[model samples]
Target chain A: MPVKLYIDAVREALWEEMERDSRVLILGEDVGVRGGVFRVTAGLFERFGEARVIDTPLAESAIVGVAVGASAAGLIPVAEIQFADFILPAVNQIISEAAKLRYRSNNDWHCPLVVRAPYGGGVHGALYHSQCLEALFTHVPGLKVVAPATPHDAKGMLKAAIRDPDPVLFFEHKKLYRSVRGEVPEGDYTVPLGQAQTVREGEDVTVITYGMGVHWALAAADQVAAEGIRVHILDLRSLRPLDEQAVVAAARRTGKVLIVHEDHKFCGFGAELAALICEQALFDLDAPIQRLAGPEVPAMPFCPPLERAYLLNADRVAEAMRRLARF
Target chain B: MMEQARHRRPEAQWRGSGGEVHEFHEVHPGEPPRHRALGLDDAQAVEMYRYMLLARLLDERMWLLNRAGKIPFVVSCQGQEAAQAGAGLALDRQHDYLLPYYRDLCLVLLWGHTPRDELLAAFAKAADPNSGGRQMPCHFSDRKLRIFSGSSPVGTQIPHAVGFALAAKMRGEASVSFVSFGEGTSNQGDFHEALNFAGVHKLPVVFFCENNKYAISVPEHKQLACANVADRAAGYGFEGVTVDGTDALAVYQVVKRAVDKARHGGGPTLVEAKVYRLVPHSSDDDDRSYRPREEVEEARRGDPLVRMRAYLTEVGLWDEAAEVDLRQRIASELDEATAFAEQAPYPPEESLYWYVYGEEETSHAG
Candidate 1:
């Protein structure tokens, strides 16, 4: 088994897709010559040529709008927005145009597009670059949101999103792009969208999380197992059509549920999962749903101490697990 | 008879006053004969007139529905009929695409969309094809006709249109895309960005601005200091043309030439149709607050529909009796469409999950 990083998996997936289909293209600021600020699209311009791997102007709105038109014209465009925080400028394209094209046209016209960006905190990217806007997109009806936690899932999910017929907002965790590694197959493969992957299985309690939080949930599961309490860790690969069935069944079997994410608690993805549990599996719950998420901090500070306090890590996940065990 | 045949020749003939007749031909330099290549004829003109009138009638019906509280929102496309219907007739509906704004019901109707779809969308009915009753009235969209969905937000569709046109270029198809917006859209940043990309890539897209004098209540004079919206195209390094929007023939001629240029790989063009706003921007807006009664009253003389009716009469293709019959036929067609739409069932609430993606991708557990 080879240890391939999530960033490498992303690059590999893009290369394979571009090679596989002439309709597939890549575009963003600094993505071509500089190989992307984070190297997610590195070496693609050299391999695919300038036409396929376009180095666009520093305008997020243009990047998204161009991709929207290209997709409508029968091209499979994958646009990189550089940072999730900067995606606000093009949020109109995502929420209004890309998300609603198929629904508005009654499936007559489809915008088969993907907007990929590096997101989440850690490595001290400061306030502007380290925010999670998945919940904002997940609330939108026409968008399918994907947040992969590992290298294998990253590559598989990217392939699936590229092949998807509607618009997909693929959120790549900047912290996990290089830190997380696993063995990925040699050929092209795709993990189905909106399907949650069960990373580790246990019986006592269920820890539902995604992206960076998936790693922390697994760590908490290990720490709790040593303390005589078992936990099931579920990583949600896609957010929009959430794996509500898996979430409810896990809560019913384990009798306790802990939802974790790096986003703030207010109107976060965790809140949606909790509501789904309350709506479907309320009687099966042993206690109220607990969420281990980033504190309600307006901005992520550059200092290590403040940043640590603002984000959810393994220690916080362990604390959440202990609380669930007590319940 | 020999003299009559010689006089009918298309070449210029010297007159007794030493002036040339300047026989009617293609106006541009290095251009070939227009009638032989374009194959345009009287039938196309008749179609354009019918579509333009249909658009106007549908817009009038929408306003009535709004006043009666049957529809939540309405954006009328009055007085801009020539620009909308002329451009619609010039493009290939099956191949060419339209990235329209909210006030594009006329354009969409000209591209083969039924009046029932407009009414259903206006009423936000369950069977509303535009947005499944989720979006407001006048936001037109139809996939079969290649009409892109319109949004309430300004200038977003400009870039989308460029991308679609670029895609067509990439596929080696000769299709061109046309995007329509009001003069107010020129102020938005997306408008500049879309134009810049379209110019740089030489994408086959036409950036059309229906300069309807006022953006909501703000007059064009206050919006900018430029001479006309077409003049702005020079900055983007493309050909810009302005035509009298009230004259359907003039708008048709200019847009048809531009559309031909784009399809032939000549690059993008900016066309500004100078028309008057005959109705308030939307049902919610009250133009009386900002626009003077005298201005509105005076602008009525240059109405596109009335001017087109005059043209039809001049061509001997229409008269008062024929106009009455045409209106009755259009009204009857609209009535049939309305009855069909009202009888149609509302969309099932359970289907709120379908079509978010393709059918093969809809099996998400959550």
Candidate 2:
């Protein structure tokens, strides 16, 4: 076992998969030479050479579009979108092309593409740089959306996405790239998609969250523990084809649920979680399902205080947890 | 006299003075006929004519079916048959990949799509191999034939074709990826991005543009700022050639050279085949609202089907009896295909949920 940073874990998965499979290749902006903006793809270019580690032009649509095409031609293409906010130019390729390739072609063709994009806010990256786009892709039926919080899940789930037979959107929270470090297995391993992991067990309240929110929830749960509030934390690693059993069971465990995410409160991934709990475990709930999320502003503001206020930190999560527990 | 009658029409009003009719014999007089010099035998030339006629006949039948309420839609290949058939015949059908737009009825047919398959898709039946009644008609795709499936969004297939080319290059195969669209599609971001990528990678791709003067209602003048769609290829670092699309032999010569060049590692070529749209855009469209009736009549006068037949006749490869027999054969084929498709059952409702994701877990080859 090795303790690895979240970004390094992701890089290990790519390196292992590329070594294991010759057909697996990476193409995106700055993925080669410069080793990606976040250095998640560092050292892969020199090891895999230029062909396997392609450095494409600064075109997001072409990045995703070429991946869609390459996947159909028996190549596993991992396309990087530079940033999640820049992925808007490629929405047609993802939603209309990659997501619908299998269904629209009646299984004659399938696009096995992995679109890796760094997402979420809190590093003073305002407007364009910081945005959560998982909710946009989760709405698409044929696309699998995954946001792994820890190094272990990041490594395992990335391997699974590379090997997936369908298209997947892998969202990596930039704030956790270096800040988060956890034990990861040394060799080949895969965490099956569409499953949730209950990292902590408790009884008073259940906090359903994912990505950076998971880390915040864990810290908040620890803070609330001294106040005699046992907070349960369920990290939804896979957003689409969500682990419904885990979500319902977690809600039923404490009869109190709080959905948290970095995305907007309206029509966010949290809304879907709240709705699922209400539908499946309504009778088991003691208090109304609560959601602690970013405000409905256009985006995270640039000002330091406003940015801090816009984000869901441990204090915010702990306050929400205490309120739900008391309720 | 027939050549004068066919070649006398102005190359399209939008083309201005640059759209001169280029005669193959004028370049190499006393050489063999156009198709012979282009490496086509007399029979192959006549076969090309047959495919062009088949496309025209099938398209006419579809229009009738639409007008009679037998089918719901008709996106025609009425005037672009020569370009489609010629480019299709020039490709290595066994190895090459064809990503065709909706108007490529003849191209798909030449690539092994049967008349029944076309009608089945037109009827959106369960046996429609293209999509199993999921997509609209003329969205051609056949796995066995190596034809990539296309969507309604224009120019998306450009990148897909380039991807196929990239695959062929990486796999060390001598396969070329051929894709076709109208001139309007050249303006799409996918088109520019795809071509730019292919140019950078030097991928083996052939971008065939059927410049039929109109994209639905938008004419060539409105669709492009440049003189020819091929001219845009210079920006992407490839050879671009504009040919008379109505001349099947000329189109064959250009596309054959382009396809051969790509297969031999010469990179991509942008070919603009200047044809015309003889009919309105689609069944839902009424051309009279935008285009005048006289222009449609003038375009019909320079129809590719008629030009191909006359060329075959000039070469002594066709006669009145052959023409009559071919029409009879096509009519019967159309009748049988129409009846079969009309009686075919729609896909079962449950199949709607199927194929959203691959049913089987395909193991990754390690």
Candidate 3:
């Protein structure tokens, strides 16, 4: 097993899948000769040739729209929206068109497409580039929103998304792309979608999180370990088809519940998780559900201190957990 | 009698882009660049006339139904029938795909949607083949027929159609996808993006712009600075041409050439059919507020159905008795379709959840 960065894991999956299936092609702005601005597709253009690794003009809506159409027509396209914020222009095509194709046409037509975007704050990407859009897409019925926090999950979830029979929106945390590294198994493997991972197991508090929040919760758990408090961090890798079993089990095992995420506090994914916990394991609760998430700001500002204050960090998670434990 | 004979060819002062003064004989006032020839024989010409007549009759009936509080809505295809039918009929039906907009009743009809299919959609009936009564009227779709179900958002279908072309090109197939929209829709960013992608990739697709003049009360002059929508294709580095939309044969000829070019891998083409809205934009709209009533009356003077009927009569392809028989036959068919749709059952109450996600996976979390 070789240690790989989160972005490298994503690239490996794309490269391996394209090599495995001739129908699989990559299309996005600067994805070909430029190998993507982030270089996640660094050598794919040279390896697969121009047609398979297409460098599209700067058009987000067309990129997704073409993928929807092409996917229906028999080709599997993995379209990349340069950043998460840029995907707004293509929401109509993804939500209104591709997502509805299967149901609207009564399964006569379907678009098996994947859209990958680098999301989250702390990269100093500021307002436009550091937004989390998983909640918005997760609300859509047909779409499957994937947010992988580890190198292993990144590779496995991306491969699974590519081979999925429906359209998938894969969000790769930009800060985790280079910062996080882990040992990835050398053979073919796929982490099943809609399953949660108990990254850390303990009994004092149940900290449910995903993406960068998982890493923060781990740090927070270590900090709280000194105080004799054990935190069980459950990484909800797949947001859309959330594992209700894991969410309920975590809530029941450790009644002290804390939900953490980088998305907004108002109507964020945490609210949904909180709702699920209430519905499935409300009587099991020892105290109220404590949510540690980004404030209801428009976006993360460009200033470093402001950006740090705007984002949810491990210290914040630890401090919130201490208060929940006290409660 | 001599003046009336010449009335068949309306003469107008035409200004070329090169600043040349010329006189052209038009079958209608806005008859595009060429209208002198058609490839259809006597019977085929008569069939084309019949389709236009049927489309017009269907449009009129839908309006009546809407007014009678029967159908929920009516998006008129009154002025663009000739262009839609012509371009639609010219395609290789067995292979090509269709992505028609809301104002494409005639195109969808020519693509094999029966009058009952349109009526069922209007009534939002259970057996409606397009969407199982899920979609609104005019959002035409037929999976078996390779028609993409379009949405209310304008220009979104352009890229989807290009995807069809992209698939064909990648597979090395000769199939092409035909997508239609109004002139105002061409102003959208997706339209530009789709055209640019198709042009760059050299995909097999036809972008047909039916310039019906008004996009919900906004005129052509207000929509774009370019002379015509087809001109935008040249900027995308593909072949583009504008033809007389009212002249069915001419539109057919131009679109046929473009389709051939695309199928053979020559690349995409943009076609603008300069059409008029003979009626209000929709049953709910009142054109009186925006433009003068005389403009609507003037457009009706060169109605495509009337012009096509005249052309057929001139070539000895149609007669008054044939017209009377065709009208009677279409009238009876319309009656049958309307009565059937009016009495059709609405979708079952539980059926609302159907098709919201994959049919196999019914357990969806809110």
State which candidate has the highest TM-score. Answer: 2
Model 2 residue B197 distance off true place after TM-score fit, in angstroms = 0.6
Runs off by more than 4 Å, candidate 2: B1-29, B360-366
Q: Write the per-residue lDDT of candidate 2 for residues A84-137, one digit (tens) a residue.
A: 999999999898899998888888889998999999998889998999988899
Off by over 4 Å in 1: A203-205, A223-229, A282-288, B1-40, B64-73, B114-137, B312-325, B331-354, B360-366
DockQ for candidate 3: 0.70
Off by over 4 Å in 3: B1-38, B359-366
What docking class should model 3 receive? Answer: medium
Per-model DockQ against the true two-chain complex: 0.54, 0.76, 0.70
Q: Give the DockQ ranking, best first.
A: 2, 3, 1
CA lDDT of A194 in candidate 1?
86
1 against 2, candidate with superior DockQ = 2
The better-scoring model by lDDT among 2 and 3 is 2
Residue pairs in collision within model 3: none
Taking all chains together, each candidate's TM-score versus the true structure is 0.87, 0.95, 0.93
Give the fraction of reference interface contacts each candidate recovers: 0.79, 0.75, 0.79
For TM-score, candidate 1 versus 2, the one ahead is: 2
- Report lDDT (CA) for all predictions: 0.81, 0.89, 0.86
Per-residue lDDT tens digits for candidate 2, residues B211-320, read 99988889999999989999888998988888888878778888898899999999999998988998888999999988999888777767777777766766667788
Q: Give the CA lDDT, 0 to 100, for residue A170 in model 2.
A: 97
